[model samples]
Target: MGKLKLLIVDDVEDNRLVLRAICKKLENFEIKEAEDGLEAVEITQDWLPDIILMDVMMPKMDGYEASKIIKNLYPQTVIIVVTAVTDPNMQKNMSEIGVDTYIHKPIDKELILFKLQSIGASIRLKQGQFKTLSKKNALNPFNSDIRSFRIIFDITDTESMMDFGMWLFDQCADKDVVACGRLDLIVELFYKLMRQGMKNQENLSIIVEESYEEIYITIKFENIIVLEPRMVDILNAFESEFIVQKNILCAKLKKYIEEKNSNFEAERTTLTEETIQEIVELKIVKEIHTAPSKERELLRQSFTQKTCAADYVSDIGGDIVDEILDLASLDEEWRERLTTFEEIPSDDNLKKFANGVLDVYAHTINSLFEFTALAYALTSLGIFLKEKAHMVVQDPAKIKTLIMLLENLGYDLVAWRKHIFELQDTLDIHYLDSSFFSSCMQIEGIMSNKEIDVDDDNDMEFF
Candidate 1:
């Protein structure tokens, strides 16, 4: 509710004064300054700040020792070391000693504010952890942020795979597209292709007597199911669309192939061990995929690992989901063609539709893949208003624009699609702030090539 109390510790009086001025300018603060690590420790004993800004090379105790003592005494306090040290290993060493962050010398004011805000958020979340837990024991940001579900369908006919792909797309279309959704379709499609590629009984060159298994990987983001589980059912319905009786047909085909190839495999006896090892490896791989556990860990490591400089999720954010949705809805060729929506090719109507979608979504092309989506555009439209809507369920302007966009486009096909539009409307109605409105006006002017009417007597600050 209130601003966090922060203790700024630096041996230099000028540095302390500079930081104090910056902190005072921030909305809420109980700023206390300490000359060195010894003073920092003494201040903490009487008034423990929510976070500590400690200079690494402070007199009397130096930052590392102070941080160690502070952490031991008050484990809850987040300590960020400020330092002039440029050594690559220094940051790592400070981190090992319980420093949460390191602000290098000549710290930019904006960066300092960003770090403080981030730390402040963490502190507030920590304080309200109990309330959040009581409200939704099932949804923990630390744990429940990710969910994994598997749908293993037997694939016998290649045509069935095609139908399944369509079914899967239809299921996911109503919801936001996620990486998982793309993967789900891939697994289904690959199985179908692999099944089709399998030689007919007479043409089979080699056959294993043991029963083989089929498994595929599908990955999508949690945003798709932000509301309910009906979306997942839509995804699973693809299996039923694959008309062939998969288990029965697969068994018959395997038998036919083994019978035809029984004579050829005996010549390659030496490769048997290698083949067996490969199968074993494949089985291990299958077993390792225990729902979303491995998938989430892989993603977490990819984004959070020190080896990576960017937070992948924050960097790509919502755009990736949009592209995945468009990609899942179309064939590979369509995806490739839509990659560059520079000019609308005159070939087909679907290509034109994709181009429109691409134009709306491809804001930061080089950031990731050069594309955007209706969902992302809609989601981003809510960004400037999201802060005000913190008390409301959703942003109203975003909802209205999203609905209009969807309606103008052809997204009104699925069952209960209206419900989604309505939800977006509700969010927009309650939460849009003046900042968001100003942003919208600017955006609208840019889009419509119209200028805002400014009164000569009035001063209006544009966002």
Candidate 2:
């Protein structure tokens, strides 16, 4: 980590000096002075200082307003208030407005240094989270009004999560029908990656700059641990222009936001509401179909050059859900039967579960040429259970193992189908390889009394 950027905000020149002197004594921070809260906010816009020493008593935008605005915009930046105000209510107000901590006006060198050091240590530990300006991204910090969010976003908030990708899909999908499902799926996957990357952190965030023509997003993350190579390949497939340095993924999404010129605007002779509605709808449809063929091409291209996909894992960028749907409609019978077997791990229940899986795979999925390997694996597992159902039911530990594997594959199968078939736009292809194959091998190992190194530390390098 580089020198910690500190912004000292105080109306009084001497107070600024005193704080600067204290910070200088530490010999660590790269300090800058702000005469008032307003200047502090303005400086924060571009500089994005690591920490701020804000004074409550300031002219032209007090500390309360400054703190609120700064914290709302850049929640990652730590703000510590320096004030003489001893009232509990005043302190409470500062805390409410997002002052990280406070020091008495008669500054204690030790106390202030302690706070700075403590916060600085934490900042250094989570080092890769700092967003650096990337050349590939077109977000002009001096000009663009970037909306920085440090939010606790839930993964399930598919409709509600407001990020560049979701905003692109939900807000603009009506304009371009091609961009709807695919764009939404890719974005939702990115968000899931964000959640996984920042699972250990208290807050996850991405800086967004929206304009009429483009969306520039600076995603600050510690890591994206792509456990499954298939998911890494899928994630790497996003065609957006992104520059990943350390952990910050700065991406630029373009071409969709620009409005295409419409002759319908002028051709409408009538001032009636219906005519206006017709014009708007026609324009949106035109944008979707005619104008964004180029946009579709941009999104359709597999962006990332590198992937963890193995040589034999040749068939990728496939529509597995569509394939399954074409073969057979996903009934909950197989999944339900698996669950039933878990409740009663008897020979009959196990046989029923095996039969359910075999029935689904042999009848529907066996015809798919691309997924023949998966078909074989699943069928083999089914046959394994059907042949050894009595033996499997006798061992509780072995039953437990089979149950875990079946339940995971079952959950993933259900989730993938639901996301793709329903109005939702999230899907995972990792199940085709990692989840399905691992479970198959492990269960077969358990049945044959052979050791399987299921937890192989396979690494996939991702930028």
How do the predictions measure up, each by TM-score? 0.33, 0.30
The TM-score obtained by model 1 is: 0.33
Question: What tens digits encode model 1's per-residue C-alpha lDDT throughout 1-463?
Answer: 6767899998889999998888776666678889999989999999988889888776689887888777666655777777767564765455444455555567657546645654554455446632321122122234542211222223334333333333232222211122222323333333333333332311111110111122112222212212124333434545332211211111111111111112233444454553456457546633432112242222222212121112323343454434433432334333444333223322243234334443333332212311111222333333322222232213344334433433322332121122222222222211212222233344333333457432211321211
Q: How high is the lDDT of residue 15 in model 2?
A: 84
Q: What is the C-alpha RMSD of each candidate to the true structure, in Å?
A: 29.1, 21.8
Clash numbers, per candidate? 15, 1
Candidate with maximal TM-score: 1
Top candidate, metric lDDT = 2
Off by over 4 Å in 1: 129-463
Instruction: Give the deviation of candidate 2 from the true structure as CA RMSD.
Output: 21.8
